[model samples]
Target: MKARASSQSKATLLAQHVRAGKVYRREDLAPYSTSVDRELRQLVDQGALHKLAQGLYYKPKKNVFGEVPPDENELLAAFLKDKNFLSFNPSVYNSLRLGTTQLYNKTVVYNHKRHGEFVLERRRYEFRMKPRFPRPHQVTPEYLLVDMLNNLDDLAEDRGSILAAAQRKLASFDRQKLQKSLEQYGSAATKRLMKRWQTAEQQGSAA
Candidate 1:
């Protein structure tokens, strides 16, 4: 009976630390209980927490409609254990008006750590390890254009047609900014492609 009471006490303490619509790893709640795993299991059984992954949990928040899902940023922060990551859908490329209209179903996270696919709370993510990526606020059309060309082979769009369209519309982008982004983020092939297009544009202008 004393053991049962102790478990309940620890559970209560852990519960106090949990916030609704927040995601947590098992270790984040370890300080509240002597046997955190046991208490976590108990919480899951009691419907106070939902297990999102092997070691991740979420506290559901209910509204008039139904339970609110944990915020994507919060979820990624918990999963990556680092806040220096950028997450976005590949569909954002379509906004560039670069002839890319196909929508991607998976979210892509570019970070210095971790690589490959992971499913978090039923949402799919393709984690790609990169040496560098722009901060959230710094992402611009120039960067997206460079990124699209960098990952051109991976995209479903017709490469020849997209390249042609981009060459035709090259004057629309800020040349200085695009060149800087290209030098920083563009792959070798993308740099070569952009250089060729710029050369052609210059020659056409001279003609």
Candidate 2:
């Protein structure tokens, strides 16, 4: 009876601490109670929270429409335990006017945590552990240009057309920022592509 009462009491306290619509892991709740696992499970059954993955959970935010799905950044932030991640899709290149119409089935996250693919809430996320990200938790234009070239061979687009389009679009980018990004995050192949593109553009202008 005493143990059951303690569990109940702890669950009540935890409910106050956990924010609605916020994702949390076991570690986040450890300081609240010793029987956190059991209390968390009870909270799930009581409709106070929803279990996401094995160790992930969230308190659902409700309204007239119903419970809202977890925010992508918030969900991943809880899972990764770090907010310093860049979330983007290969298809973002399409917005660069590069004529890349290929659809990507997954979103890529560049971070310091887990590498490879994962499925969260039925959505595919590809996490890449990089030595350094272009900018913490952001995908800048210069960074996109560098990354698109770095992973050019992997994209499901016409390689020649994409390259030609990227070369054309490169002229519109901030030259200094592009050069800086290239020096910091670009691969050798990307550097080569940038060099060739710059030379061609210079020659074209001179002609």
Candidate 3:
């Protein structure tokens, strides 16, 4: 893409959006028009804006101290914009830094063009063809953690920190709501994990 004559203000706005850490939807930039977009692309090509994926742009974060730059979840989301993506156990697995040290659980899951097997970032991400996704409310932190208990084998430990971690995470959790959620979605993979974790707790106390 070649540079085009454009308002410098639009370019500044684009940079602001990237600085704010919000993913850009092409439509969001509609106010700026095609010419502005062309300049945005040019900016990306010049290494000013990091092109996360088609139409998704970002500005690189400065690495502070010796800590490596954080894994840009926004970039990952942009990278996987095409697939039916969801933040799942993989995110938790990544947060815990528990799986194969060399691997990144991507760790998100989505239905990608109905392909049974696929690879990204040298990691395997699964896409279920059934095209099922939970409502927005169902993917909360508590629910996701419980869901991870089952979907991620690493989180499901027979005698490890999993119980403690889950318990700690859910300690202040509203029992009534979690119980209700369990009843409603228990058949779900995430819900099943909540059950197993509960079972482990009960069994441990009985011992």
Candidate 4:
């Protein structure tokens, strides 16, 4: 009877610390319970928390539509345990007006750590390891343009037309910003193409 009371007390303390709509790793709630795994299991059984994956949990919030899905940013932050990752759908390239209109079903995460596909709480993510990628807020049209060319072969669009369109569109972008993005994110092929475009632009200006 004494042990049961103690267990209940621990669970109560842990419950008090949990916030709805927040994703948590097991260690984040360890301080509240001596037997965290036990309490976590209890919480799961009680429907107070949903198990997202091994060592991960979510305190769900409900509305008229039913349970709200976990926020992608919050979910990624908890899974990676780092805020430095850049996450977006390939569909974002469509905004560049470079003739890409495919809607991708997967999200890509560019970070220094973790590579390969993972499904977290029903959302699929392709984590690609990169030595450098812009911060979320720093992502610009120039950056996306360079990235599209870098991943050209992987895209389903007609490469030749896209390349032709890109060349035509290059003159409209700020040269300095485009050059900087190309330097930072462009692949060898993209760099060479951009160099040729820059040379042609310079010659056109001279003429």
Candidate 4: regions farther than 4 A off? 1-9, 203-207
* lDDT of model 2 at position 125: 93
TM-score of each: 0.94, 0.85, 0.44, 0.90
What does each candidate score in C-alpha RMSD? 1.5, 2.5, 8.0, 2.0
Each prediction's number of clashing residue pairs? 0, 0, 1, 0
**What is the C-alpha lDDT profile of model 3 across 88-134, one tens digit per residue?**
43544445423312334444454444444445324454545335545
lDDT of 4 by residue, 1-207 (tens): 999888877887899999999999999999877799999998998899989878989998899999998898998888888888999999999998989999999999998778999888788999999989999999999999999999899899999989989988988887888889988989899999989988997899999
lDDT at position 99, candidate 3:
36
- The pairs that clash in candidate 4 are none
Candidate 1 structure quality by residue, lDDT tens digits, 60-162: 9999999988999999888888889999898999998878899999999998888999998789999999998999998999999999888888899999988
Task: List lDDT for all candidates, in order.
Answer: 0.90, 0.86, 0.52, 0.90
106-133, model 2: which lDDT tens digit per residue? 9999899889888877789999998888
- Cα deviation at 113, candidate 1, in Å, is 1.5
